[model samples]
Target: TNNLAKTACINIVTLNSVAFYIFIMSASLPSSMRKLVVKTLTSNFRKAVEIQTVPLPNPASGHVLVKNHFVGINASDVNFSAGKYDPSKQPPFDAGFEAIGEVVAVGDGVSQSFIGKSVAHLSNGAFSEFQAVAGKSILEIPSMQPQYIPCLVSGMTAKLALQESGNLKPNEKVLVTAASGGTGQFAVQLAKLAGCHVIGTCSSDKKVNFLKSIGCDHAINISTENLGQVLKEHYPHGVDVVYESVGGETYETCVNRLAVKGRLIVIGYISGYQQPMGVATTTSARGAAALPVKMLMKSSSVTGFFLFHYANQWKSAFQELSDLYVAGKLTCMVDDGSSERKGGFRGIDDVTDAVDYLYSRKSVGKIVVNLASSGSKL
Candidate 1:
């Protein structure tokens, strides 16, 4: 009897709840508000977003409207916030490299098949509720490639910069600096897949364990010990290739230990980014006492990489990186936080906290900004 009574109580409560919801929803909601709620909510749809009502520009032929699902925040975004990067363009603009959104509308020549498709794409003006899309910058991710979204957007260049410049071959030995950084982990994993013996360098002993967990055969602590001696002990013949993400004294140390004909791929200037207030500012090839390259006598080549400049070729990089990722050979580590909210930015002001974090070097790997939680405003 008691069991029957409990079931009856549950049915009553569920019915009342449904009835209340029906009453609330039956009221005619404004078109603006109805447009706001797109997804079929589950478990109390919890998300905070900055909404903007823009004049709906008709998608030109070959264009589709993208209603963003997830936006990626990268170091470049932080740099852009701080006014640190070069080649400035006109302002009063949207600043973002990539966003994943579903198509809400499409222009002529666009197929109806794209109506509900999830897309991963590069674009400016992505840190918002909606964005106008240009079809050329977008690509539909097939179901099989769903999991590769984070890596393909955040760490894609990290992979290509190494593969293209490292000239990695099967069974060659490779070492990566800042191995636990966003790009570093992927570089190490990619090298290992190429059958290379992988060594990783990190600032902390704790990071070394994470490195080793993901295909790094060895890890050196760059913060405390002598790097050259450590490398000599582990890589007796020296390492064949290096993905140089953090440059500085580390670069000098790494350059000294390169095997003859080794290749050094330069992907970032993280080492020079922050110097204390009183320290001498570095200029001209990033400062240090001059070293005679002739003395090392190695045929190693150093190549620089800048992803945005390769904008025309982003998908090629994404496709290859995605393939390796789906094969279970790569990992992307995200240091996600609420920079977007804590910074209280609207429009351009949104970038401040993220910029501060990057300059502070307060986090590791790809620092992701959680826009939903931060209380910051523009």
Candidate 2:
């Protein structure tokens, strides 16, 4: 009976030690984290933001805490910081849009199963070490690869904008402006996959080569050749669908070149992103009065596409893009800041430079900032 009691005591002590160790491990997360916030409203993204260290946020009910590994930089980031996207938005707001990470904790009523899952989300404050996002917003990916970051915003925009808004049909003649850009690359490839004859416009010979490599039937180097002249001579009937992103005169050119019954999907007006909000708005409104008559003559229509407005279709669109990527039907190009700049964009400190590189039009594809260091793999 004495021996039995001793054994019982030893077992009790072992169990207690294990439980204590588990508690310590779970509580090992740091008390604070760093994040970028827009302290001022400016077109110059570098000057508009500041880094701040604050207490790590706990997930609220129906939310999950994610430790970000990579974040995506978009052209609209400048518009966001400048308050062009939302004029009512004030300063000191979070700066980024999309990130890929591993969920470390679940909030009240959330399934603990979400913890440790590799997920991606498109939400504000993505350029941070950690973010607490709604549990339902998380996209469970195959793994935590930087490649998946582009798929969230860039890929989804191209897929949905083309199919849903552009009304893309097989064998249709499709034109993509800024064709070698982040979302442009996806638009070019997706149009090709749908059996459409694709035309892409770029500024440099290098970008022209890239467009051709991606199966673009016509890679127009706008620096030397005229986009208007090329389309007029080769595609006299005009294009069936146009993915127009570059605004200003480019927007006018696309509108004038549309075929009868053609559809133009306006995803962004990057040409005016650096201008003052009023100037950009005025530039966009320049031809609005004549637009109705123009469309009526050709039976063509212009549609605007904003990803945030189509939240319900995001999940299914992401799934289709993921499948295409896995099956090698789709290619995700991520510019990690090596070719355009020194050292490459790694961590929150480099996010501003990455944004500049994107606006420089030197990047060939999606610009991503690595938040997780070599030793920090979660």
Candidate 3:
């Protein structure tokens, strides 16, 4: 049998005349060298990022030093780079949020047994070769492949948004807009798993087929079909739960299609992320009455959901998602599309290109960038 584990090699890289070593092996336990991905002060999603070798720090007490094997790319990564997440935030900062890695070293008070365990993490510095994550943030997994990284963010977010935010119930009618996206794909499957009849919206026929393959009950090509008409004619009673992300007109449509006592969970508004940031006006300004009034009339509710804010329950959510995957109830579809400049984003250097491809809004599933991994053959 072929062992999928690949060996990691140490590389000496120079940044501004200073040379630093990346990925120090146990034999060379200096613990003073590391590598990180950074962006300049004026850099945005439209600009390129830099990979620089820096002084690596030993794991702090109760923390584990992990050698990252794979990192998950999210739309939030683009928003963070574009200065939309925090306008006051300056550059020369590390990017990325979720990753899967193996514990190469442990800090004071941590067990040495963690050294070889593969785990998933949601830490601050994931877009690099290594991350010293606090022990509590790690979720032990069976594989270190880049594909599993999406389960940390997109998967957990989808599970929580439906179960916690939407209060999903079996046999209910559920609707997910942007249903072919990272989180949306998971939402579609999870809703189906819960015995809900799912209606997903996508922009293209390819994505429509992708959603259908994943067990989505009804896939609507919003680019070609009239969404409002489809809902009115086919689902006159409206849907029970709406997992909404794309805002603006799509949000309005979802709101209008809410069944009595229905719940609408707002995850993000990707429609406005690329545009100039500004204060948002109420629905009444568009000649439509207040959305709250409409919700009140139907005895429905609208709530917002942000996964990071519910950090305490992340592990529990991941546990359920992992079980589902292990039991063959959940599947992750990864989009391997390339940008105009690169054939495929197989290395860290192609992150910017990957982000650009995501913004093009053409991918059908989770978009991931594979990191070169070096480990003992299993």
Cα RMSD (Å) per model?
11.4, 5.0, 8.8
Top candidate by TM-score: 2
Tens digits of per-residue lDDT, candidate 3, 1-378, equal 133222211122223122222234454544454344547433255463576777666789999988777777787776666667677877777778888878887788887667778999997768877788998778999887556766888998998888787888889999999999999999999999888999999999999989999999999999999998999999999999999888877888888899999999998887766555563522445524577688889999989998988898899998888888888888887775543334456556656666777878888788876666322211
Could you tell which candidate, 2 or 3, scores higher by TM-score? 2
Candidate whose lDDT is highest: 2
Question: Candidate 2's residue-wise lDDT over 146-254, tens digit each?
Answer: 8888798999999999988888789999999999988999999999998999999999999998898889999998889988989999999999999999988888888
Tens-place lDDT digits, model 1, residues 1-378: 999999999999977875565455334222331012212211111121123454545568988877665555554553443335543543333455666666666688877456657777777666655566877778776542324445655567766676567778888878888788767777887788778888888877778778878878988887787788998887777778888867666777667677888887777756554432234433434434443472247877777887776676678777777666666656655554443344322232243344455445444556544333334443
User: Which regions of candidate 3 are displaced past 4 Å?
Assistant: 1-24, 28-43, 86-88, 279-284, 287-289, 338-343, 373-378
- Each model's lDDT comes to 0.62, 0.89, 0.78
Query: What CA RMSD would candidate 3 show?
Result: 8.8
- 254: Cα error in model 1, Å: 1.8
What TM-score does each of the candidates earn?
A: 0.71, 0.90, 0.85
Model 3: what TM-score?
Answer: 0.85
All candidates in order of TM-score, best leading? 2, 3, 1
Better of 1 and 2 by lDDT: 2
